[model samples]
Target: NIIQNVLSPFKPLPDVVHRITAFAGSGKTHTLRLLASAYPSLKILYLTFNRDDDPLASEKDNKGFPSNVVRQTTCSIARKETQAMGNFEEPRKKVVRDFLERRLGHSLNYKVVDVVLGTANAWMMSSDPELSEEHVRKGEVCELKPEFRALDFVKLAKALYDAMIDPHCHEISMTHSTYLKKFVLSGAEITCKSGGPFDAILLDEAQDVNMVTLQMLLAQPG
Candidate 1:
């Protein structure tokens, strides 16, 4: 039963995106370890969603690593890349709240700003600006408090992106999704200075990764 359910599907991987879905305790980490051990020469970037759940840390403590292996939480990688090119900051909750309050030209609850940022981040990660506007007009996007329109959300996102690029005021602290969105949108080159262009990128617990992170992975040259 174990062979059929788990081991059988763990055949040799091809050079493409391979998604493995299974219930917990299905030996996903074991499979990843096997891949890491097998290909010692290939530069592999292993990513996980939670820093506490990093498999590479456990592996290093237990069995050590090959010379070329790199491991990080997805957010860590995004922040590292963003910092490498220029000065960057993650936006604080208060700053975001104040920005939204001013943009809407009225006071807003802190929770409202949180919701707006969450919705706007998800929208930016998944859809282009034009399509997002279309979806907003079509009533596809979620409605927010004070009857904020789609254009309002779009403008807010653009403002955030602008803040990220501002040279004098590098005060925008960004979430992982926002950072990735800005990284790609700015036409910034992803280089090997941070240990990339890896021959194989292994993502354990990949189900937890968001679309923006996935796009960042796909942006890597195969």
Candidate 2:
């Protein structure tokens, strides 16, 4: 027993949370490159908020980035997860039509439906559920016209949620944040069976992350 215990390799310590802060033009990207070069074996998730900045645009441009590193925007991550989970039906138009028809017992023109959907998307992205509901109930969604207030924000929120989780649906059209929020709320395990996909996750433009994104990140094993 003593020999076996002595010979057994020690388990590595759990990773701790890391926060890297720097000013504009600082070497944040450089720092990440250095870390990637130093730890070639480590599986890394490098997330950025900039949709235009493809981290892997050019291997020569990102010379130090290891092959094990996976780079993506938070929205892209959410999109991929949604695609992997199931066939989520595209419900942008259906959600608006159903909510208006079922709740208000009224049919709206295509233009009105479009406006309502745009408003719903904005609310879902904002993360201020309570205030959004209150404003909707108070008929405050449109300041220029009270007729637009016929749409109930609460019902609209529910409609969006229902459309996202509908088993028979085939494609998800909701925003990335909405999909991520739904995925997390559905009790899906964020960490893999072997702990997680990566040894460390690097988030760029962290300030742009919404509550749902932050929660998703926090759910991952450090």
TM-score leader: 1
Which sections of candidate 1 miss by over 4 Å? 1-15, 51-64, 84-97, 100-119, 127-131, 134-151, 164-173, 187-196
Highest lDDT: give the candidate number: 1
Give per-residue CA lDDT, model 2, range 147-191, as digits (tens): 655556566655655655565654434555567666556545443
Candidate 1: which pairs clash? 89-172, 89-173, 90-173, 90-174, 91-173
lDDT of each: 0.60, 0.58
What TM value does model 2 have? 0.62
lDDT of the structure predicted as candidate 1: 0.60
Every model's TM-score: 0.67, 0.62
* Per-residue accuracy of model 1 over 1-222 as CA lDDT, tens digit each: 553455445443544666777789897766776666666777676677753425466553544545666766766666565563432344677888777777678776655555555555656566253324432332333444445443465566567656654556555654555666656555554445465467777787887876666776677677
lDDT of 1 at 51: 34
